[model samples]
Target chain A: MAWDLSSDRPIFIQIIERIQMDIVSGKYNAGEKLPSVRELAAEAAVNPNTMQKALSELERTGLVYTQRTSGRYITEDEAMIAGLREKLAREKVTEFLESMKRLNYQPDEIVPMITEREETQ
Target chain B: MTSLLECRNLTKRYENKTALSDINLDLTAGHIVGLLGPNGSGKTTLIKLINGLLYPTEGSVRVKGHEIGVESKRVVSYLPDHMFLNDNRKIKYILSYFSDFFEDFDSAKAYEMLGRLGIDSEAKLRTLSKGTKEKVHLILAMSRRAELYVLDEPIAGVDPAARDYILNTILTGYNEQATILISTHLITDIENILDEVIFLQHGQIRLHATVDEIRQREGKSVDTLFREVFRC
Candidate 1:
């Protein structure tokens, strides 16, 4: 996956978000081995130390685990993945609703608009 | 840990003009640092002093806790802004020259990078385009396992694609314990990869902070902050 990072934010935090998105999207399946820090750093075009810091953050969250003498692997917890997926969905929906309200759409009209857009899709 | 490069009350003057004045800074290991400023901001003068290409008029520069000299030169790999390679030499000859001059030079890694870039080893330096020459220089500089890599405008005067390639090479090539100090005015292109940034203005150090601190506290990118601070 292409690592699209903005310069306004901390790169390590962005790296963590990207990896989390990848895991939730099934780009990296649960229990699968993740790429080494160097490999990911090269792919992301970031400093290796930054990538290492991001991976350690993930390990702290229980989203990843490191095996001695081997490398890091994604968490095998299905519930955690589902929880993250829900959290992301809610955040995106909240953003959408906030924008809609700013455009003068009532909360009542927002649901129908979303339904209409969904049906058209 | 001791700093990899330290400048204490460093000053540089030529005749009546002062290029850098009473500057002091310390850079530790394992960081990709951006030395940022506008034209004639003393960036080059400071880098030249660190590389021992030019002597300071006052104070001193130290590498790995020692004064800048033969021992410091051995650990500091420098890539100047202009073309430092001989235009008459073949790429292979240049690689050989680097290997002979620097004990830390990795000829095999140089060949691998050359092959990856599709640059012919037998091609003369003058035969290649300007961008290709820059790439060759960068490859040579990064092939050294030095403790400090001082790159002067490595991404300047190149297309976006070439800039990306250069950044990637630097990211992958340096030793883990080494520090890279890159001098450039193009802040946004190199900002994401930099662990810390040092802002230079009028031969003085303005600010030195981690990338995260600037973004988190100021709520602006380095490029935006640079424009604000250096507005004409």
Candidate 2:
């Protein structure tokens, strides 16, 4: 996942979002060992402290686990991963629908197109 | 569960004037605390007391459940505002000294970080630029996995770009379980990163609270409050 340093949002939050995207894109497979804090900081050109903050947030959200003296690993629970994916997907759909409504698009005009796209997928 | 640093009604007097009076502090682990104060407010004095470099005329100072002494010195890592490393020694030699003194020094990590900065270990300390020298000092302080890190003015006088680098090093390099106490007047730059703050004014702790709690209660950033509280 790409980490952009110039974003106005906090760096730690951006790091968390990038990791979430990686999970969604399968860049980090279940139970895969993530990079160490120092490695990630070097890779991203961010402070090691910022990287630690991101990792701490991921741990808080149950997306990663630390094995003492070993390292942090991606959660292997497929159900948990799927649950997060579905939750994010729902949020996106809700946002899209809200945008359409604001643009004066009726449910009859947009829902069928969405349904057709899902059917094709 | 023992406190890393403690003070009880600590007081210090300088030349017939009180620098600090009745200042009590109890700090625990897993906290990156900010010690905020204006000039001559005694923030430095308080830290000196904790590091065993200065003795309080009244009350007491303790580290790791023992009064300030040799054992406390062993567990506490201090980075004073001024340069402490010998100007003639090579960076690698200093690293060796640190390793010998602190049993928990992570040599591999330290070397890896220096490599990232493109810093060679053989260079003499006196030959390096000021910013580079500051980084070297910070690297040494952070390489040790000490129980408490007392950094005084860690980034006060560096260039903006280098300032970010130094702050990042501290953030990423230190052990998460250890307590870090940073004393500085640059509250805005570090306000976002702190777990809590101990606002010092006229040699006393005026406010101490979690970052979130402070924002909630004051409806303002700690920097804003600091300016208002210490406004002339």
Query: For this target, which candidate reaches the highest TM-score against the unseen true structure?
Result: 1
TM-score of each: 0.95, 0.70
- Model 1 residue pairs with clashes: none
Off by over 4 Å in 2: A1-121, B159-162
Q: Evaluate residue A90 in candidate 2 and report its C-alpha lDDT on the 0 to 100 scale.
A: 93
**Poorest stretch of ten by lDDT in candidate 1 chain B:** B165-174
Q: Please write out the lDDT profile of model 2 over residues B118-230, one tens digit for every residue.
A: 78899999999987887777777777789899998888766676666666666666676788999988876766557778988888888888655666577677788788888
The candidate maximizing DockQ is 1
Candidate 1: tens digits of C-alpha lDDT, residues B1-232: 7888989999999999898999999999989999998899899999999988899999989998888899999999899999988899999999999999999999999999889888999999999999889889888989999989999998777778767877887777777888999999888888878889999988899999988789888888989999999999
RMSD, one per candidate, in order:
1.6, 5.5
Question: What's the residue-level lDDT of B134 in candidate 2?
Answer: 78
On residues A54-105, what C-alpha lDDT tens digit does candidate 2 reach at each position?
Answer: 8999998889999998999999887888888898899888999999999999
The interface root-mean-square deviations, each candidate in sequence, come to: 1.3, 5.7
Question: For candidate 1, what's the RMSD?
Answer: 1.6
Cα lDDT, all candidates: 0.90, 0.81
